[model samples]
Target: MAIQLVTDQLSNVLDDTLRSQLVGNFKEIEKALNDLDGAQARLNSDQDKINQDLKNIKDGNEIRDVNVQAIVNILTKYDVPIQIVNGKVVDTTKEGE
Candidate 1:
């Protein structure tokens, strides 16, 4: 069996001082719910900002990909073989060829 506080049992408690304390408990519960609602609103706002920032990051990545493709296209137009060694771009074109 579970212990539960039914409304009829609460009404049977005839002490005026004890009844006043119960009213205060309801007020505290209401305040807590209000605080939770406010926090949820702030979380929702932050989530929207985070979503927009993620979209911006995705857009930046696409722009970077397009730029890299353009550079590749331009580089392919030339016949000079290029090499990257030790974090440096080196022209590997032979003088005789």
Candidate 2:
């Protein structure tokens, strides 16, 4: 769903005329957002893996809080605030705002 939106926006974000007269840091912003999404996806996948590992664990080794903190750090570095409600990633950013 989000991937389609990114594709659609990429098509319109730069036209020849506008690209020549750029006034803001949109390119950098877009790159940062893309990086953020990639990191978020990796974090989510790792989290799922952690959950599966937990279910299969039979020993006393516990999950470390720092592991989750590392993921949060990556997201924060890109100015992406992850909205997790009831164990799901929700988009809180306003559209075209």
Which candidate has the highest TM-score of all? Answer: 1
Clash count for candidate 2 is 0
Residue pairs whose backbone atoms clash in candidate 2: none
lDDT of 1 by residue, 5-90 (tens): 33444555578856866776677777777988999999999999999999999999989867765665567567547644564456
lDDT of 1 at 81: 71
Score residue 4 of candidate 2 by CA lDDT.
Answer: 24
Per-residue lDDT of candidate 2, residues 1-97 (tens digit): 2322223234354676455334234665677789999999999999999988877673323344345556666786798876555644555678886
Candidate 1 local distance difference test against the native: 0.71
Q: Considering only N, C-alpha and C atoms within 3 Å, which residue pairs clash in candidate 1?
A: none
Worst 10 residues of 2 by lDDT: 1-10
Error of 1 at 32 (Å): 0.3
Summing lDDT over every window of 10 consecutive residues in candidate 1, give the lowest-scoring window: 1-10
Question: How many Å off is the CA of 56 in candidate 1?
Answer: 0.7
